[model samples]
Target: MIQRDHIHMLIQINPRQSVAKVVNLLKGGSSRVIRTEYPEIEEFLWGDSFWGDGYFVESIGNKNETVMRQYIR
Candidate 1:
């Protein structure tokens, strides 16, 4: 899941899942894990919504860096 300048994980979440729910779960879980492993990232992790409202999901093909960057934006 590690790239030179980034990382890409092929997670297979439910297709019908709500983006908000998924984002919230991920954000909360990730922050907790980061805090548990190392506390320094906590300050850098706190935000209103780290993920955008909408998502660009690619189920059939590989997503390019530009596309992934836009998705994370």
Candidate 2:
């Protein structure tokens, strides 16, 4: 879900995939699309990057899947 200043996503990653790599792919890919589709965004940017430098992640178990999905929603 997209919010005013942030977004919430509930994703399940493969065991071999690193969270950092996933975040990078998501940010980098989305940045390209967003910038290409809306060049006006450059006016509001403070730097060269579209996304912030930091990200927050957490690990959830099957028992808490419902709770996590609710939180993301």
- Pick the TM-score winner: 2
* Candidate 1 colliding pairs: none
Tell me how far the alpha carbon of residue 62 in candidate 2 is from the true structure, in angstroms, after superposition: 3.7
Model 1: weakest 10-residue lDDT segment is 48-57
Top model by lDDT, which number?
2
The true-versus-predicted C-alpha distance at residue 22 of model 2, in Å, is 0.6
Candidate 2 TM-score to native: 0.88
Model 2 stretches with alpha carbons more than 4 Å out: none
Model 2 deviation from native, Cα RMSD in Å: 1.2
- Model 2 clash number: 0
lDDT of 1 by residue, 1-73 (tens): 4444444444557779976687678757875786789866546644753333454445645657667556554
Clashing pairs in 2: none
Q: How displaced is residue 65 in candidate 1, in Å?
A: 18
Query: Which sections of candidate 1 miss by over 4 Å?
Result: 3-6, 42-56, 61-73
How far out, in Å, is residue 14 in model 2? 0.7
